[model samples]
Target: MTIKSFSFSQLADMRIEGVGIHASYSIDIVIKDENSSSGKNVYISATGKSNAARAAGTGSLLFWCKVRDLLSNKIYSLERKKGEGFAVGFDDFVIGSIMFHIPYNSSSAPKIELEAGYLYDAGYAGTVIPFPRSLKRVIALTQFNRR
Candidate 1:
């Protein structure tokens, strides 16, 4: 499987409900492997940092890294702060983390897109950093794929 990413900006327009908003973006991905089987395990990982800070009352903005499977049309997502939560502050950036798993596959390279957003008071504001366009870098890993 090959992984790549780019930068995104569409997210800058989103807002939570009452909290502030700050986020970054990356590009999509496409995983292709001939060893794909019925129970092969596939794993994808992504990360980003805040480029700017949102307005006030925005609480601590939240960011997330997501992976989308074009073939299955299913998505596995991860957040920056799993349970610890976020605080409202500028220059206080938190790292987002996400881990996902797929049952298995046969012979298809599922298209993947890496998305991120900032959790604000208005709503989620972010975008799916397009591949070879917006993202700067991206990576993909198959934790364990048994035949």
Candidate 2:
């Protein structure tokens, strides 16, 4: 079994007035492989604080995660099981995480690209802000198998 982890810290503040969201966030991603037939699992965790007051029932603050298989150019998005996202208000904070599995054959290793960020929606429209350049990464799974 092998595991790879990456961390990201935001350098600047991000805000979307449409939903009245202002925050600074950090994210951690972990990829784990058990060398089994099932494949690999990817986990994403987001932690942040909201510094401003949210619009009165006008919108919501949400987190998003996406993974891409560089070899096949296929993108897989996180599936939210429970509520949409964190329930944050003025001077509030949130810590949320999601996980998904990717299936692949053992004969070959694929390079994976990951992207994560915040999404603000005002019922009518929405805005998406990527975490940061450092948060977006391309990882080669083969490296983990090296002895």
TM-score of each: 0.44, 0.54
Evaluated with lDDT, which candidate comes out highest?
A: 2
lDDT of each: 0.42, 0.52
lDDT of 1 by residue, 42-95 (tens): 544433445333434333445555666555567676665534645434344334
Model 1: how far is 124 from its true place, Å? 18
Root-mean-square deviation of every model:
8.0, 5.7
Per-residue lDDT for 1-147 in model 2, tens only?
Answer: 567676665553445543332345455666664533556665544443333225334445455567787756777775342244454554333445555555665456757787665554445564445334224767776422322
Shift in Å, residue 119, candidate 1? 1.5
| Model 1 regions more than 4 Å off | 1-5, 14-41, 51-58, 81-108, 121-147
Among all candidates shown, the one with the greatest TM-score:
2
